[model samples]
Target: MNGSHETEIRELMKSYFDGLYHSSSDILRTVFHPDLAYVNGTTGNYEHLDFEEYMARIDARTPPASRGDVREEIIERIAFKGDRIGIVEARMTMMGRNYQDLLTIINTDDGWRVLTKVFSFVERKA
Candidate 1:
């Protein structure tokens, strides 16, 4: 990928991490597309949530940052199939748990938008 594309994707992922850290709906909405489909099956059941549901969950939760939860995020990789489609893998720390998320991103007329997320989380034992 070109440097500019990489930079743009980095910023978008940064927004995603910041949104999760702060529980900010606006920031989350900016990076994620409205028709986003998020799936997680780590809890033994296949679960899916749309963008609105996800944002609502974020709104309901107390931000990890506010609780003094130490947070770290790393963008593991970004791969592109063409000019429009990209995939990102990242690991993050929040709410005393660790999460790894695979995000599918697309470059639209508006800009780069996260199309979907498939994630897994592990709760840390005290």
Candidate 2:
């Protein structure tokens, strides 16, 4: 990966983590593509969402920050397919769940944006 690309992607992930922690769709919009695909299958049934649907869910949720939850986020790995495409593996804990996300990112005229997110999570032990 180009150093600049790595730096930009890391910044994008920071926005992503903050978005989830705050449940702020406005912040998320800055880092995600308008046509983003969101998918999950941890419950044995495949589910999919477009950007609007994902944002709606985010908007409806109580922010972890509001609940005084401790934020935990990690960028586990990053790899490039070419100059304009990359993949990121990330982990975060929020809302009593620990999540792992595979994010496909693309470099657009607007800079790096998450094109898709496929994620799975396990409920945290109380």
Winning model by lDDT: 2
Misplaced by over 4 Å in model 1 are none
Each prediction's Cα RMSD?
Answer: 1.1, 0.9
For residues 44-117, could you state the per-residue lDDT of candidate 1 as single tens digits? 84699998999999899898889978889999999998889999999998887788899999998879999999
Which candidate comes out best when scored by TM-score? Answer: 2
Residue 80 Cα positional deviation in candidate 2, in Å, after optimal superposition:
0.5
lDDT of 2 by residue, 27-108 (tens): 9999999999999957884799999999999999999999999899999999999999989999999999999999999999
lDDT of 1: 0.91
lDDT of 2: 0.94
| lDDT score for residue 107 of model 1 | 96
- For each candidate, the alpha-carbon lDDT, in order, equals 0.91, 0.94
Q: What is the TM-score of each candidate against the true structure?
A: 0.95, 0.96
Worst 10-residue lDDT window for candidate 2 reads 38-47
